[model samples]
Target chain A: MKYGYYPGCSLEYTAKPYDLSCREVFKALQIELEEIEDWNCCGATMYMSQDTLTAYSVSARNLSIAEHQGCGEVCAPCSSCYTILRKTNRYVKWDPHARAMINDALSAADLSYTGGLEVRHPLDILVNTIGLNRIVDRCVRSLEGYRIAPYYGCQIVRPVYHFDDMDNPTTMDRLFKALGAEVVEDYPGKVRCCGGMLMMTFEDVALDLNADLLEGAVTRGANCIATVCPMCQMNLESYQPQINAKRHSNYRVPIVYFTQLLGLALGIEPKKLGLDDLLRPLPKLAPAKPMEGVK
Target chain B: MGISQSVSPPLESELRSAFWDHVQMIPDGHKVKTCLQCGTCSGACPVSHAMDITPRGIVALFRAGMIEDILKSRTIWICASCYSCTVRCPAGIRVTDTLYALKRLAMEKKIYPDKFPVYALSKAFTRNIRKYGRNFELGLGFHYFLKTKPSKLMSNAKFGMGMMKRGRLATRPHKIKNLWEVRAIIERAEKIGGGK
Candidate 1:
């Protein structure tokens, strides 16, 4: 299947690993990712908080570009991008005032969104569109030794999106299990906030939130936390030292993109998957074992 | 306490009624009036402890005709926009979106708490998007630290350097090829009221 890719800004910088691994995984699965040309930022929560119409107009520009490219659905790997874009889509569809304002704004650049462009998260696309059965057929390496805490973060599931259970999302859990990894079933901080850009604004509060997530994963015997959001990965992984120092605890847990693990399961090289970019190294995965019941 | 007592009842009621009308301007904001006084939003909020007024308290204060107090409090800036409360609210109040509206209102009125980095960060972030059509993380950090707490820049320099060494931090901004289109959209939106 072909999809338009919107990496957003973070994927171009701090979340480059997510971009790399997502490309590799999609390639292995033969899902073509056509990037929308000259896609601007999604106007994340920052712009949304300041100006409503401008934020929607900015985000809608990307949708307009995707629609121009004949892409019916655009996949955003970042949760913030996914949420913001989806929110824009929802408002444009339901709120007439927003629709008129956004379209009028878009008309300035000779672009307009006529609706029907789907804004999707990579996780939703992989687990739902690709399906687990097809994924199992492609797995060349088992994650038998990996105990993964699937950190869903906040955006993808919340605000009553029908993608997955907001409180207890199991798409990642199910995907990890299908790859032969043991899922941390009772991970309390699975859907918790990773403080987003608050890490830059309010370091102490963000650190505390990340600390809670790490402490939850570590206590659940998770060797690493698999995440779907760039901000969550950065906040939870990059802030471990500060969290350790501030919270008076030791935490060396590797926070990785779920796509990276999926890429590994698909037999992609670790380097190609951007595994080396991780601040904390993922524990070595044991060699693939014989299939128990599968062909 | 002193401020409310100083206002005559007629003027206070007028301000309170205006506040209610303003709340209705928010997207799905009318649902806020349906809040059952349940603290579900506060209980669900991960960072409510850091908020000067909890999520539920914002609604309660609105009921108490204290919109100014809510705007000046750190509650709106402290919202992480996690939307936990929005989803969990029994009354289906869009608490997070209300917070966003409050943030915009606070910014418009310049009524936020002083020395709050969230304002600086948001301003820096939006400015970066406007200038480059994408976030320039290094520049964003430089502007944020310079604005809110210049002293923290020294402590953060090492962290920034580490990110740079890891190939995660881009020294230069990534400007989109069609930045003019983004600029046009913003300018047009501004002319069209920008939902202000």
Candidate 2:
């Protein structure tokens, strides 16, 4: 299936690997990702804070562009952009006052909002479109001996009206398990904020909470942490050292995208998985030989 | 609608105005005015039992002009940013985002310390993600405990060792080959936020 793809600012910049891995995985799964022509930032954190109506207009402008391009869905890799855009669509559908204000703003950009189109997170496409049964059937390098901790972060499940189930989410788990990975489960301060841009605004507090969540996941026996949000991925991966330097300790855990792990199970090469591009190096996993000749 | 008239306390008057000040700064900021005081959010909150005041209760406090109590309560910090109320709100007030708005104000006001164990850990988690493209759990976990001087837990070394035996902890880190690139990315991100 083909999708209109919006990688957002972080993916275009800080989280390029998320964008790269997304293309690689979707290609392997036979999904065509047509990049939206002349796409700009979704106004992720700033517009939302300064002006709600304008935020809706800008986000809707992007969505309307995809619809104008005739794409049925706009698949976003960044959770911030996904949440903002989805929430904007949701708000405009019910509140006529908000709808009118945002539409008037959009008219300035030569755009309009008609909210039937779906705004999907790439994770949703990975689970819902690739279809778990197909994911299971395609598995080659099973994660049987490895322990994985799937972290949803806040934006993905939150504003729950826009995304999936807030509590007791199982989509990520089902995908991981299908790849032959042992799923590590627990209360992970789940649905907790990774402090988003707060990492920049309040560095100390953000790092502190990072330690709490990462430490708890490690103590719980997760060999690795997997996530779907680029902002969360970038935040948690970048901050571990300051945390270590402050205490004069060195703790290293590899944060990665689920697509990387799935790519491995699908027998894609490691370099293609962007494994070496990680902030932290991963431990040796006693690499499994891939199955020869799968259609 | 049936209504009863009573003396509107002065305490309520001051508090309500302040809450509106908070409301005005946010996107979809005025949803506070539409709050119906239903308790669905409090009911759905996973940690509501642990909160000094529940999510819906905070709205009641704001509406009643008792926001000083909100400023003082540990309830703001207790939020995981789960968005339970944001999803469930009849008015859709952006509950999680709004709490964060309060969090910024609370921090500036010194309403609470930044010393919560969870706070330290989360900060480190985000910092590391920025440094590397991903997380290195080994460095992150031990790094946090060392900084906090939660060394009192050192007596529990046997427990740590036992877990190590079970292959829970990796003594050796899996260093990514593109360390320079990782360093560059962190540098750029830092520049974007400006001196964090």
Candidate 3:
């Protein structure tokens, strides 16, 4: 399963866990993440917001790098990075004027993108590469009893450009079901932003918005929420305590990365699975005392 | 909307003010001033039928501080964050970002909406980041579904079964090796306030 892996800036700095864990998981699944040489930023949605052309050009530069590596599909672990790259690719291919401008911008960096490569998210790669049956076959311990929420943050499916179904994308839900957990059916904010940009500028907007989402989950009877995007992860996990404090509520739902649960069900030790690194310590699913059925 | 839009207003009272304060940080944040209300964004919207306020109206609600209604309305959940409004808006307003800003503000109010499934979705994403450092759709999806009520799980059974048949979903435990490095990274994220 060797492929071009672009971990983006966040994974390298703030979201290193995503990059490192992705490598670890792929290794176990016999998938390989060959880094694209001399990769650069995906514009962080910043360049795009400032200058749309620069955004397209920056993304093209990254795509051009992947092309140089002779890879057909470049897998991006960050949703922001994935969306930015995908959006830029689609624009250049779909709009000749924009393509010309982006191409000209790229030439300033002495790079040329031929628009033959595909940019994909890590979740897309996992499902496409491992296949559902392989994931099912690997799940010795089934999440048969847990009611899980399949979360797809704003960037994954929204805007309906060069992606899956805009409203109801089943990719995340499909992947979760194969892993032995029952996927919750509610349509809670799958494509909604978690105030990613505001989190940087305004504290109240980010924390309060996240609290509302958390409160909704508590009412929905979701014990665990699963997500494929890191920004959503950080927003929900970090904001919970603040929600509890300011709102004076006990919404103690655990915010976990979908991969951590996969590693756990696969019998990976808690430490190895990165269980201790959360805002609120992850609570035990059951009493420490041995359960009737749990090993 | 297969996905819900924001309810009425698009910003909270205090946060609405802050959006402008932060708007200064953004190079072109003032683009909001150009809205002509041609009704193009609302008319073109697939989910406009579901919103109490048109996409254009939602913006008006923001400026008016009729934000509480917007924050509590079902429309916030309906938003797909499609950015179609932004893309197609002749006014070039950051309508999608404003919508997201509304969701963030609404969530802070601790408003619980059960009809939409996004609550679970957001929670699952949050939990995934906390534990795995990344997302595993198969694992997280199952974890999310299993965590829900029995009847809710049944409603999801159809989709669950489809994953089984397609072999696109996992039915087994999938663990990654060398996860210790990932653990350290997560710890750092929290210590550095990536998680509150």
Candidate 4:
């Protein structure tokens, strides 16, 4: 299956491993990811705070490019990018003024966004489109014994509610199980915010939020916290040390991209999936027997 | 700490029509004006304690025509935009977007809390996006630190070096190939009072 990919800014920087593993996993799954040419920033959460029209216009520019490339479905690895892209798509369709303003902006570059493009998260593509059965069929090295906490963060299932439950999403949980990993079914931080750009803006607030999320996973005895959002991984993983220092608690929960875990289950080398690039050291996992007759 | 209550409430004629006009401009902002003020937004907010006024109080301030007070306070700038308030609002008020509207208004009025690094970073981020068509992390960090928080720069030097060593942080901007197209869109949107 062919899809247009918008890696967003984080994929090129702080969340590069997510981009790397995402591409590798998709390639192994036989999905073609043709990148949208000349895509700009998705305006994230901050941009919209300043101007909705500009935010919508910028996000729509990406959609227009995806549509221009003749791709019906465009997927983003960053939850913020996916959320903003889809939010802009919906906004322009209803808000006439926003639509006109965006159209005016688009026309300057000879681009027009009719708002029909389907913006999806990589998790949505894997769980909904590719189907869990197909993912399980390709798992060669079962992640059987690893207990993983599935963290959806806030954006992916929220506001849009396209393919998963908004309050408590299970796409990542189910996907982890399919890959032969033990899913932490009641992971509380699943729908909580990872403090997002607040980490950069308001350090104390973001750190506090991160502490709660990390503590929730660690307390639940998760081997590692698996997430689909780059920001979540960055906040949860990078800030663990500071959070521990601040809260006077010792926790070493590794935050990994779900795609990276999927790559491992597919028998792809850990290095190839950028596993070593994580800020936190990968938690050692106990080897488990592959389920009999699985392959 | 009680900044919201310190200001003398505006007279009826002092109520700016522009505040309501701005609210009506966006669908979400319009919804916020219809808030029930049930305090769900305030309660749902994780960072409300850090704000000068709670989310529900901010909405109440808007409804009561306290634009000047809202602009002067740091509540809008302190919002994490987590959408927690937006998701939990029983009135289906897009509380988060309303907060965004308030931020936009604050930026336009140049009334954000002084010496707030978050506002500085937001400005730097936009400036980077405007110039490069994409965010230049190092450029943004430099711009932010240089402008608002130079003291924190030395502290972050090690982390910056680490990111640089790992090749995660780019030394230069990664401008899109068709940056002029992006520039055009930005300019056009700015002209329409959207990218102010």
Candidate 5:
């Protein structure tokens, strides 16, 4: 399987581990990723708030680059990027006024975008397109005892019905089970918002949302939470200590990118997957020693 | 505070039509006029407790053209854009998108609550994008921390250091290769879209 990879800005800096582990997992799966050349920020929601046409134009520019590269399908690892790109692709295709306005900006750069590109999230590509059969065939180490809570933040499944249910998505759940981990069913935080854009600006609100998501998962006996979006991973992983301090709770859930777990299950070294690069150390998938009385 | 204190006399016809026109222009925002007042959006909002005005109230206010009455409240800034309200609205109102449109309109009117970090942070983010054609995390942090609210620097300093140590934060901006192209795009977009 081959794809045009659009690893948004976060994957390059804040979420480097996601990009690293994602590449390794795809390599193990024999998937090819061609990073789109000269990609710009997807403007997330902030840019859209400032100016809709400019935001659409910026998103269009990225698609135009991918289209120029002759890539019919472009995959973004970030949920916000995927949503924005997909929205632009769909908007420009259907809304002639928006299309003309965005094209006017594009024409200024000697670029005119004719939209037909398929914008996708990596999770969509992995579970839906690649098929679990291929993934199951490549898993060298079974995560038989590991308990993972799959957290898909708001964007991927909402507003646009791509490949999963909007309210209760199971792509990651099935993906994790395919890798041999115990999927935490009925996890309330499964489709919760991570307050991605507000993390920095509205710290209090963001922290509260993050705490709910972590608490929801850990209360369900999840060893750790597995996530697909960088914003979700970073928000949950980096703020657990602070959340614990404020709430006076002893929660130590290590948030890991789903790709990192996939890499581990595929027999990729921990170091290669950038496990140690996480703000919080990786939680053991299984206990180092058996409990004295539990069994 | 009850809703009556802020209510202005029914909005002038011209102003009411203008507001509706703007909302109707954005995709799916026309649903603003179709709000059922069922309070589904308010119930679905995770941060509604922090909001002074409920999400449903905001929609009602927009439809009523009493935006000035709603503008001062921190409700719009508090929205996490989670789409819970958008997805759950039985009327299919783009609650999230309408909120975003209201945010922009609020910013344009300079009515967002003073000293609110959301405005400052968004300003810093847009400034970074305009300067480099891409968001520079380090630049954004500095701009937001130093320029908007320096007090946050001391509190968030540890997280800042952690990001730097883990190589998650950059000290300098990362400019896109074809920056001129990006600039031209932004310039033309501003010229065309700003006319409104």
Candidate 6:
């Protein structure tokens, strides 16, 4: 199957590993990813705060391009992008005022969105569309020793999206289990906020929020936290030293994109998956066991 | 002595009704009238402790016609936009969206907490998107620190350098080829009242 990919900004810079691993995993799974040409930012939460129509107009530009490309579905790796894009689609489809205004805005650029495109998160595509059994069938190694805390952060499953349970999402949990890893089911911070852009302007508050997420995972004996959002991975991973300094607690827990782990199970090399790009080093996992039916 | 009045007299009736009308204009803002005073929003908020006026308190203040006071509080900027409150609200109140509307109102009025630079970050982010069609992280940080707190640049230099060394920081901005298209969209949206 084929899909259009919107890496968003973070995936190009701070969350480059997420981009790398997601591409590598999809390739290994034989899913074609056709990138939308000349896509712009999704306007994230920042644009929405300043002007409603402008935010929708900006996000709709990408949808217009996707529809023009005949990409029936667009997959955004960043949770913020996924949420914003989907929100824009809903507004264009359901809100006539917004639809007319956005179309008017689009006309300035010679573009329009009639709303046939589906915006999806990579996690949903991997777990639901690809299915766990198919993923296991391709697995070459078992993640038996890794205790993973599946951190969903916010945005992806929120605002009442039916892709996963908004309150207690289990797609990542089940995906990890199917790969032979022990999932941390009691992780309370799974759907918690990772302080997002607040980490930049309000350091203290963001640090406290990240500290709680780290403490929750570490105290539960998790060696690493698996995440789907780029911002979550950046905040939870890169800010550990600061979190440790302020909280007076050492938190060496590695935060990684779930795709990196999935790639590893698929027998892709660590270098190919950008595992070396991680800010915190992952703990040594017990040697992989060969899949039961694999050579 | 007669019981002293603690609450201030409500705003002039005209101003009070105007403020209520503005609140109801937010997406699903009419739901504000249906708020149960349950405090579910505040309880679900991750950053509510840092907020001077909690989410639940914002709705209560709306009923009290104290939106001006709410605008001046740190609560609007402190919201991380996690949407926890929106998902968990039993009354189906879109709390986060309501806060976004308040932020827009505050921006329009040029009202914000004293010395707060949260708005600076958003300005820098949107500026970068407008210029490059995608966020230039390096440019965004430089602009943000300059506008908000120049001293932060020195302290954050180490972290910035680490990111650079890891190849996570792009030295050059990634500009889209069709820059005029994005500008046209923004310009047209602005001309059309920008959803006011």
Q: RMSD, each candidate, Å?
A: 2.1, 10.9, 15.1, 2.1, 3.5, 3.0
CAPRI category for model 1? medium
Best candidate (score: DockQ):
1
lDDT of 6 by residue, A58-167 (tens): 98999999898889799999999999999999888888887898999999999999988889999999989988888899889988788999999899988857599988
Q: Name the candidate, 3 or 4, with the larger TM-score value.
A: 4
For model 5 the local lDDT of residue B148 reads 65
Q: What is the lDDT of residue B143 in candidate 6?
A: 85
Better model by TM-score: candidate 5 vs candidate 6:
6
Candidate 2, residue A120: Cα displacement in angstroms equals: 0.8
Q: Candidate 3 chain B, which ten residues in sequence have the lowest lDDT sum?
A: B187-196
Q: Could you list the iRMS of every candidate?
A: 1.2, 12.1, 13.7, 1.6, 1.5, 1.2
Q: TM-scores for all candidates? A: 0.95, 0.68, 0.61, 0.94, 0.94, 0.95
Q: List the residue pairs that clash in candidate 5.
A: none
Ranking by TM-score: 1, 6, 4, 5, 2, 3
| Greater-TM-score candidate between 2 and 5 | 5
Tens digits of per-residue lDDT for model 4, B8-113? 5443234355455556656756666467879988887888888887877777776666667777777887777678777788888887777776777677667667
Runs of candidate 4 with Cα error greater than 4 angstroms are A95-97, A284-295, B4-15, B194-196
Q: What lDDT score goes with residue B145 in model 6?
A: 89
| Residue-level lDDT tens digits of model 3 in B1-196 | 2324444444444656644543442234588778886877787554566565688776666566665656556566555454657656776676765565455445545564454444555556544433543444556556655655435466546644643453333454333342333344334323332122
The 0-to-1 C-alpha lDDT of every candidate, in the order given, reads: 0.86, 0.65, 0.60, 0.80, 0.81, 0.87
Residue pairs in steric clash, candidate 4? Answer: none
DockQ of each: 0.76, 0.08, 0.04, 0.67, 0.67, 0.73
Model 5 stretches astray by more than 4 angstroms: A284-295, B2-18
* Candidate 4 structure quality by residue, lDDT tens digits, A1-295: 4699999998998888888899999999999899998899988877887776777888899999998898978989898899899888887777777788789888988889887788888888998889988888877777876899999888887765588887788888778876777888988888888888777778888899999988888888788999888888878877777788899999888889999988888877888888877777676556645545443
What's the CA RMSD of model 1 in angstroms? Answer: 2.1
Off by over 4 Å in 1: A288-295, B1-25
lDDT of 6 by residue, B153-174 (tens): 9977888898888889998999
